[model samples]
Target: MTALDTSKVSIKTSLAACFGRNLYEQPGAHEFLQELSQSAQEVNIQQGGYIFKEGDPSDYVFIAISGAIMLERSSPKGARHVFAFLFTGNLLGLSEFTVYSFSAVALTGATVVKINKRLIQNIFERHPKIAKSFHDFTTHVLHYVLDQMYILGQKTAPQRLAHFLLDMDTRLGRSSGQFYLPMNRIDIADYLGMSLETTSRSFSNLKKRKLIEIESSHKIIINDRAAILEFIDE
Candidate 1:
């Protein structure tokens, strides 16, 4: 790992900085991230680079600073499935069960803070509160995963897309109402377990229903939030 320009730490750092105060308030979280700040190194990977491969020994945990990484699993037949999109402040490689159940690959130029696993364990041991915070974090992640499962397993294509858009809007909102998206249809398709064509068609349907408007390929305007939510609920 190389030294990063401290002045230009990415959104991951911003997220950490914004939440760091609250994180410190959490049980043992301050000492953990502080120690982690000392030991962790900032590293960058190019788009499409593998951060860690599936089945690799879990040696380090990653905290995304910028860009996005996909956690994916592949079948024996080589068919690939995406599991999650890890954004800034997301913890990587913290599982105590399997070494790594999926591969983490950069979706774009990515920066992450890499912390040694041993150091993480030591921090957790020294502060049981740190362990509890981690536990709560993982539990929240699990709930999000289950929600993703519900979207994939039951919803129609358009509904799934609506749900995805709403989720992105909610998560990335600037003033809790407006948000801009960096990901395109293909990324959404891969995340939603659908084909790109289907994803595109879903957007078309949403536009036709006046639920959202595609200002451009990379831009969207959600017209009726309530209607979109109702559609998703159905």
Candidate 2:
């Protein structure tokens, strides 16, 4: 097989290893996802694969099993704007309020459980808590998206990258003042809406400041996380 095919197979294996089954399928989390799991199915995507294109029909709401997905929009001019990174435990294509406004592409190989909207609707009708949980989750997502907008509109390139790193570190449940980055520089740039060169320079600047060290292509070791968080808090 070709190198690209080998890489896809490796990613698929890693994703399967990380998540043997959907976490939400368990008896918890208000049963919204669990009930839907009865009829749900999982699909795997190769790296750089498009899960759904823009203007596609919104049917199944996907729950990620492993890796990450990037939701982006492309203009006729060929410029691309990444909207957000959907990580494990995040849902994709759940636009109950209106039609989906973005397209999702796999950033890495990923596994997702596809849930029927009709099934989810029935569950919501029966259990009010499920609806409340979904509302809360979506609200949290909106707040993060708005925060990204603020970062994009107001923050400098360095600040934007710093804030993004800090936020991801916090979410990963790493120590309160410790962190790392799992994505590559280009992915980070796309997620932050900056050039790859800018992103690399920011990392160099951070390292020179003794704030962090690039542990590997897929990892960063945070040093003075306190100062980083302090700067981000401002």
Q: How many backbone clashes does candidate 2 have?
A: 0
Tens digits of lDDT, candidate 2, 1-234: 111121244334432332233323423433543443356666888888878878877886776667678888877897777777766666778776445567888877887766677777776677665555666667877898898899898888878888877777765434554444435677778778889999999888877877766666556666667798776667
- Stretches of model 1 off by over 4 angstroms after superposition: 3-21, 26-30, 175-180
Mind sharing the TM-score for model 1?
0.85
Error of 1 at 234 (Å): 2.0
Best by TM-score: 1
Candidate 1: count the clashes. 0
Residue 78 in candidate 1 has what lDDT?
86
Candidate 1 residue pairs that clash: none
Q: C-alpha displacement of 191 in model 2, angstroms?
A: 2.4
The per-prediction tally of clashing pairs is 0, 0
